[model samples]
Target: MTEVLFYHLQNMALESVLPPLLEKSLERGWRVVVQSTSEERADALDAHLWTYRDDSFLPHATWRVADAADQPIILAIEEGNPNRAQVRFLVDSAAVPADADGYERMVLVFNGDDADALAAARAAWTDCKARGFTATYWQTDERGRWQRKN
Candidate 1:
């Protein structure tokens, strides 16, 4: 069973929060896939990943680009994983299919301020629980660090 992680974004934007998680995953030798609801979102994330921090480098590519399998991180609007990622990050309420065995873990990041996003996350969490996947809820602390809520 795939581990489902729900990140409730309260104090920061997705761009601000994503890089560190990606970095940690890379440190663990896990290739990553970031999925969004549209091409524009994926493109924006692809651009952001390049310049998110001046000191660090995240080698990533959009799905439309060539040599996708060579990238450590692949951003896409589609569900396909070209990089053979071990972990997946689903942003902006991106839907997760019923069978998610391709990846070892799935991370769902949803904005707390957006009602629709929260609702979708809630629904996904419930579905994941019903499907017998191990689900965890994480929220930011006062210092803006992630703390497991449930």
Candidate 2:
């Protein structure tokens, strides 16, 4: 069974939140594919992940790269998993991919401030549950700690 997680971002930006999660995923030896809504956003995330922190380094490439299969992380706008990742991250309001069941986990990170994103996340949660996934919801507390809501 696939474990689906819904991360609800309140005052924080995706740029601030995503790198740490990706790091954790890598620490667990899981290859990742982060899907965005557009090529521009994917490009921006590709750049941000490189310099998100001075001490941190995320080995990644866009899906367009010839050696994408060699990267641990791949940023893409489309649905295919180029790196044979065990985990897939849906960001920037990207919808859940059709191949969601292929991964060990599927993470949907949505901006709480954006109405469309919030609605989309809700819909995705319902869809995941209906698909028989073990769905969990998380929200940040006052000090920026993740608290499981359900």
Candidate 3:
């Protein structure tokens, strides 16, 4: 069964929160696929991944890039997993793919301040549960740390 994690972004932006989570996934030797709502969003994240930290590097490529299959991390606006990623990240109202069970884990990150995002996240949470996925919700605390809400 796939494990689903929902991240309710409050104090910090997705840029601040995503890198650390990606790092943890990489540490576990898991390839990752980041899904964005649009090509523009995926392009922005592709650039952010390279410069998020001056001292660190997260090797990743956009789906349009030539060597996508060779990358451990892939950024795409679609649902395909060209990199054989074990983890899939859905952000900015990206829809969860119907074939999501292929991945070991699925993560949904939404800004709490956005009413549309909040509603979509809630629907995704409920849908995941109905699909028999083990779902977990995480929220940012006062110190900007993640804590499981349920």
Candidate 4:
């Protein structure tokens, strides 16, 4: 079973989607491990989650690009998922939380219809993949929905 962190809303803003998704995941039936930029998002989703007391938030520390060993996977989600990770995640994608999990081999998504941003993002995804990680295009529909390239 794949653990998924679904980030969605009528408007798709962090403030709008984070709370309800947390609540939905906490019905006590889902066993998905979520990671967000901070515990604030987690706490906002579920009160039982590990959050910092008095507003500090349950974060070990933020991740920095300075550490070469732990590079992040890149994904451009049509609609990003919710996260409550204890560390700050660096993002280059418009979808803040990336996917359910970062990939050892990335399954990159692109809007081939866009023609320009697609080309650039594809290049970036390719560079990461070339370093022994997997990369390929998952073309999107006209409304920016994902349909894996078969």
Query: Which predicted model would earn the best lDDT?
Result: 2
TM-scores for every candidate against the unseen true structure: 0.96, 0.98, 0.97, 0.28
The TM-score that candidate 3 achieves is 0.97
**lDDT agreement of model 2 with the native:** 0.93
Candidate 1 lDDT, tens digit per residue, 1-150? 799999999857999999999999999999999999998888889889889999999988888778999999989887888998999999999988644666789999999999999999999988888888899999988988889985
What order do you get sorting by TM-score, best first?
2, 3, 1, 4
Give the better candidate number (1 or 4) by TM-score: 1
lDDT of each: 0.90, 0.93, 0.92, 0.32
What TM-score does candidate 4 reach? 0.28
Q: At residue 103, what lDDT does model 4 achieve?
A: 28
What's the lDDT for residue 29 in model 2?
A: 98
Between which residue pairs do clashes occur in model 4? 7-81, 35-85, 36-84, 36-85, 52-57, 52-58
What is model 1's C-alpha RMSD? 1.0
| Structural RMSD, model 3 | 0.8
Candidate 3, 129: how far from true, in Å?
0.8
Off by over 4 Å in 3: none
lDDT of 4: 0.32
